[model samples]
Target: MLWFPTLSKSGFRSFIADNDEGSTGKWMVPIPVPDIGLIWEEIEDAAVEGRILAAKKSTHELVRIIGHNLACVYCSASDPDTVAETLRTLREIGVDGELKYKSDLATFDGREEYLYSSSEFETLLPRP
Candidate 1:
């Protein structure tokens, strides 16, 4: 199973794009994770740069550190209670933001599809 870290649009683009640091330091580029096992090491590496920290610490500490910029979408592969724990921790820390779940729409024949489920969808779609 793969887990995608939910980040802001800019952060997501930055995470996927290649960058060069000019002549000051070596260019640090993000690499795609081919396997889930590499996630921990990658998180540790990012933590060193202060981008994010591992959640091995207390929930309170982790919540305080994560703040309100974004909340990681608890992956389906994680324990069922993981999302609840994260939400509880976030609430305890008084953080503002939503904990989202991964979802998709697909046809029975395996074709991928995208459809708006919100009330805005009705307003946006042309009336037949």
Candidate 2:
């Protein structure tokens, strides 16, 4: 059930297309990142703050990869050779768990907050 951060386009598409039912649901890929991995949450917060919600590309990719693999262990099925490269590509595109920012006030349309720098995420976020 451990899931990796990135996979190829074909890999991604194949993952989500899988169909099945059992102890593992169709999209039951548990995020393997540490500490509940605030990546997705942070991304949502970033989008809402900027008032420009981003399409859930990475999330969908994960669904796809898991679906295609038809197994919760999508990350395990990943080819280690390409894992690093794919992660690099994702990072470059701001799709790699990076709460990407854009400077377009027209899109901002009011809802905006100070950007969440890496150093500020833990502090800025309310403790549960």
Best by lDDT: 2
Against the correct fold, how does model 2 do in TM-score? 0.22
Which 10-residue window in model 1 sums to the lowest lDDT?
19-28
TM-score of 1: 0.23
In candidate 1, list every pair of residues with a backbone clash.
none
| Residue pairs in candidate 2 whose N, alpha carbon or C atoms collide under 3 angstroms | 14-68, 15-64, 15-65, 15-67, 15-68, 16-64, 18-67
lDDT of 1 at 6: 33
lDDT of 2 by residue, 75-123 (tens): 1122322223323322333332333221222113343532222222323
Model 2, runs deviating above 4 Å: 1-35, 51-53, 57-128
Give per-residue CA lDDT, model 1, range 38-104, as digits (tens). 4334433443443432222123334345431222322122222333343343333333332332221
Which residue ranges in model 1 land beyond 4 Å of their true spot?
Answer: 1-77, 103-128
Error of 1 at 108 (Å): 21
RMSD of each: 18.6, 18.5
Clash count (model 2, backbone only): 7
